[model samples]
Target: MVEGIFHVGEALAAGDVAYLVQAPETLISPFGRDLVAAAEANGTPVYPVSAAVMGAIADKDNPQGLLAVAHTRHVALNSLGPASQPWLVALVAPQDPGNVGSILRAIDAVGASGLLLLDGGVDVYHPAAIRAAMGATFHRPVVAASFAEFAGWARAGGYRVYGTSAHGRADYRAAGYTPPLILLMGSERQGLTAEQTALCDELLRLPMRGRATSLNLAMATGIFLYAIHDALDQQGYFAARAS
Candidate 1:
């Protein structure tokens, strides 16, 4: 369970809340009280606890006076964005929860279609990932699939798969980002393997000019996110995500 008020609020807005725990501190805060009222309206049970008890139950170091538990929404590969402009970010076996969360934030920031977690990686709902993601976790379509499943789906969907790698020959800026594509980011410890990279239609690389050989996973993904948006906007191919 997570303790941030806004996070819980987002959960409530999405009708994803199972329940909520309220501490005395929230009684005095306007938004906190609003959430409790919203919870009641939604028929979600609310449990009141002392701050000490809240601290004991919450995962955050400093509890936000509210804790919300919501069922995870398992988005399917076929149910992702529109086939015409299905720009997606796929992370392969990402080990860091914080990185996954930050990448989700980046996805929301750039208005990308969705995120796909391939193979096994940090859960999209891990507390750390949720905390790091703020409330963006509840806003996007997140799916989990095996690498093979994803590859097959991409082919069937006519997607252009672009893998990101340090050794990739094509510069990220120069590469074409046609719609219905996947930007696959490999694990932080071990980037895309040769075989994995081979699955992509092309491999994209960011420039390395400084002593630092690589950029952090979230940072690289953000750079790419913006670049794709800029390119699409310039080409008049950009559209606000369809509801």
Candidate 2:
């Protein structure tokens, strides 16, 4: 379910299957008009409701005039293969929905392949996550799996898993991010478990000079993703994609 004009617009632009859209009678933004037009073009029903009614259905503190109900899209873990240039972000037992959503947004920004949720933390479909993602959730595939199941799949697919840790030997910038790579992050409260870290082909750490000992999950993931993207780009990853 997508709420607010911005999110609804993103869902429509991404070609998500919308079942219905509801808007207040007072909605007059050009963006809202375009959204209504697009929904109607795709044969989706757009219902006009009272502002009070809209408030009851919308989840935001400042509810926008638009809301959309759309189908969830995800692929099974078994469906993943050893495709060329695969770059994936895997979260193990992520604790916060907002963090999950922010991470998804970052993943989209870096043009990574997709996201993998291992052993389940927050529901990917949670409204907070969906809102925080700013429609990125619609832009990429998100898969869920257990640690053991994911480990088996990664092995079979020749994926090099890179786990993050403060005590890691290799600096994040120094690590090699080859194709078919997986950036594995642990939960907020607890970092990667012993078993989880043990499975990684390489353990990486971000340098910290300040008094702060750690970064938030979303921030840390973003830093790692952009760094990996830069490193891969320098190695002709983007050039290969263009060809």
Candidate 3:
């Protein structure tokens, strides 16, 4: 079950919200009432309870007036073929759930095709990750696979795989990022290992111009995702849509 207005609303829009539980006072607001109407239109059950009752169902100090039950949405690796997502970001065994969610949000913000959580990472559905994503998890295609499996898929689909490193010789901006590509980011704890880096078509690094030698996993990944996007834009990659 997902909690909060944003998460529930996204799930409702995705047609997965089965039922809703709301606090009595929320009906006075427009968004709250609209959510109830949407849920009802879909034949979803809406239960109104006192604030005290809501607190019992919620994980937070404040229940935020809503909680919802939604079915899990799974995205298969094959479903994310080249056409489905021209660019993809793969996270390797991310230790922190919030970082995973933030990266997922970044992927959505930059219009990347989807996210790949490689190896055994935090559950995407974990409330912390889902909450941090601010409902982005509901619509984006998220696939979980081992590094080997993901590598094979990328190779078979003819994708250019770029791995990030602290000591990579290639600057990310100079690397010619093409579509049907994957930007592979390392784990929060250990970054990328030698074996993992070898699988990549190229290795890239961000400029450490300041005292800081590294960046937060999500922040670094977001930077790389946008860099690739801007490069594609400069190449007139988005022109076809306007035409």
Candidate 4:
């Protein structure tokens, strides 16, 4: 289920199979209008409910006057293959739904190939996750796999695995991200195990000067993603804009 005007509109734009849509009669925002138009265009029923009814059905504290129940699409791990300049983010057993969704948003922002969820973690379709993603959940592919399976796939696809660790010798900015790179992040509580760390081609770390030993999982992942994005841009990854 997708809630909020932003998420519901994104779901409609992404061609998700929408079963129903509920919105208050007083929704005047252009976003809400676009959602209704899209739903009508696609033959999806839109029900006009009162604000109280919307509150009862919606999950968010401040409902955005829109909600949609749609099908969630997932990609298989084996189906993913290497590209000429692929960038992927792999999360291992991420505990927080908000973090997972924020990471997905980051992945979309950086134009990464996709996200790989390893082992067990929060469901991507969870309401909190979907809400936190702010519609980025509809923008890219999310695959599920085991650590071993992901490692094997990364090796076979010639992807350089870069794992994050506090004890890593190489600084994150100084590390070279080769083409077809996969940034591996561990869980919030227990970080990547020694065995998992061993699988990485290079382990990178973000320096901490303050009393805080580590950064939030989402913040850390965002930092790495943007750093890698800047590096790739410097290497001419993106095509020059025609002025």
Candidate 5:
């Protein structure tokens, strides 16, 4: 295969070859060179693009030189399971690609199993989301679906679904975030709905220490993910099994 530079949107849309993004060594750089080098050492091709193209991906007020590409990777949700260690974050009707990407990064950091993006949420394949994900997309399972279908599957799979809401009785930190748990985050402007609210096994709320009413979707997700990670560690979920 010949090496050539391409736009993030164009390369990802083509979807037939692996791609990598290379950003410059600047404060505003969208990606780290170490990440690009790592992908290359692992057999993934990496290309550096002109700053103008990088700007398109990063949404800079003015263009700069930075970008990379390779064939995109394919992922299957069931590939990560017995559905035993199932920890999923559900985004229903989220409109911002940046928020989706941030949440995916958080999921990757905490070693979550997968993501179930409900209908009306931002497109996972959107270039902006991909950029925001900062390469975590390569390591996480994120599948898009309608809320109805996902909720039904969650029930059938015996997942203990928890929704975040202001009216929740329990603090988010107090919840048991074990395996087979699904954390649901609603839209940015409005929180969970009556219909969706009814589907949750329980409702949870984050405590406002500084008097802020709520947290950003991404921040809330990060907090909950770390909480889940802490819970898993406490339960010896990270321990090796005996033969």
Candidate 6:
């Protein structure tokens, strides 16, 4: 039995453990009572805690009085499974949990195979990051490795690494995104380091015309991913006919 496993009615109904507080009403506003009762009927344990105790661990500002402490799921980095091409996304030197989570979500949305986080990047399991991911962290494959290890592996695997930068001349839209590609994104304030930046086959940037000097890290990552998807789509990624 997990010590911190709390069960809210809906989470239980959904066959998942949930942490519940004294006022079930607060937790069920979105889920409703019928769903809560069904969860309880389905053998989902609802462990209620005092408001003070719950407040201590819950995200107070937006706590739904519901949470679940469960084992973290792990996904290996190398095996992206069957696809027209393999794509790896690297979160390098990112400190913000939200940005990391958002990047993970974008990676999943674009159906990227693997996610690699540099040593100095934000913790993938951080609560804030998990929330920002909107549950994508659970499904996305990820690995943590040093730049040297990744460079060696990428080289051996024939992966073309494209690093995102403010100084790069190549526009991402114009760049070719072939199979076995590694897309590297950097920190919010400082971009990639000299060593990491040097490892990339090409450096690319998003075109910007607004007053802001550049785009947000998450937005930039999404743009690059969508651009790749577009490129692949144009090349008849899943068409029955051969290109």
Best by lDDT: 2
lDDT of 1 by residue, 124-235 (tens): 8999999888778888888999998888888888888888988887999998888877889988889998768888998889999989988899999999888888887776
Tell me the tens digit of each residue's lDDT in model 2 across 75-174. 8988777574399999999989999999999999998988999997899999999999988999888999999999999988999999999998899999
Candidate 6, 127-212: lDDT as tens digits: 77777676666566668877777777777777888998878879988998876788988767778889889888999987778788
Instruction: Give the range where candidate 1 is weakest over 10 consecutive residues by summed lDDT.
Output: 234-243
Per-residue lDDT of model 4, residues 167-198, tens digit only: 99899999998868999999888888998999
Residue 66, candidate 2: C-alpha displacement in angstroms:
0.6
- The TM-score, computed over Cα atoms with residue i paired to residue i, of candidate 6 is 0.78
Off by over 4 Å in 2: none
Candidate 2 vs candidate 6, TM-score winner: 2
Instruction: TM-score winner between 5 and 6, please give it.
Output: 6
Candidate number that wins on lDDT, 2 or 6: 2
Q: How many residue pairs collide in each prediction?
A: 0, 0, 0, 0, 11, 5
| lDDT (Cα, tens digit) per residue for candidate 5, span 1-243 | 111222333334344436565445332533344444555676766666556555656544554344444444555444444244478899888888889988988887887777778776687766677767766665667777788877777777788888999889888789877567888998888888898899998898888879789888999989988987888888877673221
lDDT of 1: 0.84
Between candidates 1 and 5, which one is better according to TM-score?
Answer: 1
RMSD to the true structure for each prediction, in A, is 1.9, 1.4, 1.5, 2.1, 5.9, 4.7
- Runs in model 3 with CA error above 4 Å? 26-28, 241-243
Model 5 regions more than 4 Å off: 1-66, 69-85, 209-211, 240-243
Backbone collision tally, model 6: 5
Candidate 5 least-lDDT 10 residues: 1-10
Per-residue lDDT of candidate 3, residues 1-243 (tens digit): 788787888888888877898887744667867888878887899988998888887887766788888888777888888876888899999888899889889888887888999998899888889888887888788999998899899999998999999888799989999888999998887888887898898899999989998999989998998899899888887785456
- For each candidate, give its TM-score against the true structure: 0.93, 0.95, 0.94, 0.93, 0.73, 0.78
